[model samples]
Target: MEEAKGFVRRVLLLKFKAETAPNHVERLIKDYSNLVNLVESLKTWHMGKDANIKNLHEGFTHVVELTFEDDEGEAAYSAHPAHLEFHERAWPHVKKMVVIDYKPTSFHT
Candidate 1:
């Protein structure tokens, strides 16, 4: 593996509480995605429901991937009001969440 350079990827694995409604989940995704437009440093956002065929997902049912130009961009995004507001609003719906951030790298066989 080798560093791709000048990029940061944030991965969010979320398991919503069983009682959370589908409609609410949809709204959360919408609001979260909107951050990319609201925060200048947020370069990209992608989200999806879990579709893993293997039973390895523990209990997480959704995933969100965020890309930034670099570490500074990601830090700015984290401190941005849009992101803070969204996190405050959405945290209650999540039963469990795992957040991982890393510099993107290439994997070669």
Candidate 2:
């Protein structure tokens, strides 16, 4: 089979503490959306719930997927000030988080 090629996609699953306020989380989401908007190399960004309910252990309250054209693009995203700011503001409220990165084999929808 021919090898597929494209950007690196990062998947982030976050579970916030039960004591986290809804409004604060919503504000953080807005901040993230704004940060994504500023990144030119970020091809696409999507965030929401996981559709499958049966795998509750693997499920998270919020999921964020980000695509970058290459390793350099991803690196730039990692060092961006806005990204750092978002983490500083939101990390304290997060109870747990999981991150996975891979080259996308395909995309639908």
Candidate 3:
């Protein structure tokens, strides 16, 4: 496979625990939306509750899409203190999560 030599993306799928409160879920989404201001390398951000056919989602309830300039931007966002704090706020409510980082070739989502 050829190397991807362009922008990078971080995609996250979240499933909140059954007992988590609704308000906390709301806050989690807000936190994600705010990262653009706190992290300079964050070029774009989009997050929302899963609206797909309920049966298809299994337990995942939220999807977050983040774009970075490059691998360095991705690394910078990962280690940023604000990002760590955000994780703390969301992790308590998250039952399971899937994270994928890749460079988009034909990607024009």
Candidate 4:
């Protein structure tokens, strides 16, 4: 959707360590959720495991989405102390990750 102001969307795909525990993975998601709680600039947060319908998943098991109100908001998130903490704690458990960002070009309604 196009906004009169502005908006940003972040898509994150994650592949966890091969032997990572299920409970540890769950904690990672929970801690990630806390980033949205602590960052005032974050507009929305969502995440889930891959469906594995096809081989395209490429080992990535989880996906996360974040929405921000503007460029400033997104930038703030990158620099946020809480986010930095989460990044440090989460990176070790992640075998790989893909992050893509975009602004909506059109609105459906």
Instruction: Please list the C-alpha lDDT of all candidates, in the order they appear.
Output: 0.93, 0.81, 0.87, 0.91
Most accurate candidate by lDDT: 1
lDDT of 3 by residue, 50-75 (tens): 78865798889888889998999989
> What lDDT would candidate 4 get against the real structure?
0.91
Candidate 1 overall lDDT versus native: 0.93
Ranking by TM-score: 1, 4, 3, 2
C-alpha lDDT of residue 44 in model 4: 95
User: Candidate 2: where are CA atoms >4 Å away?
Assistant: 1-3, 55-59, 106-109
Report clash pairs, candidate 1. Answer: none
Error of 2 at 39 (Å): 1.7
Q: For candidate 2, give the lDDT.
A: 0.81
Order candidates by lDDT, high to low. Answer: 1, 4, 3, 2
For model 3, what is the error of residue 15's alpha carbon versus the real structure, in angstroms, after optimal superposition? Answer: 0.2
lDDT of 2 by residue, 12-75 (tens): 9988888889888888777887876888778788898667758775536889989888888989
Per-residue lDDT for 97 in model 1? 94
On TM-score, the stronger of 2 and 4 is 4
TM-score of each candidate structure, all chains considered together = 0.92, 0.84, 0.88, 0.90
Off by over 4 Å in 3: 1-4, 107-109
Worst 10 residues of 4 by lDDT: 1-10
lDDT of 1 at 46: 97
In model 2, the Cα lDDT at residue 94 comes to: 90
TM-score of 3: 0.88
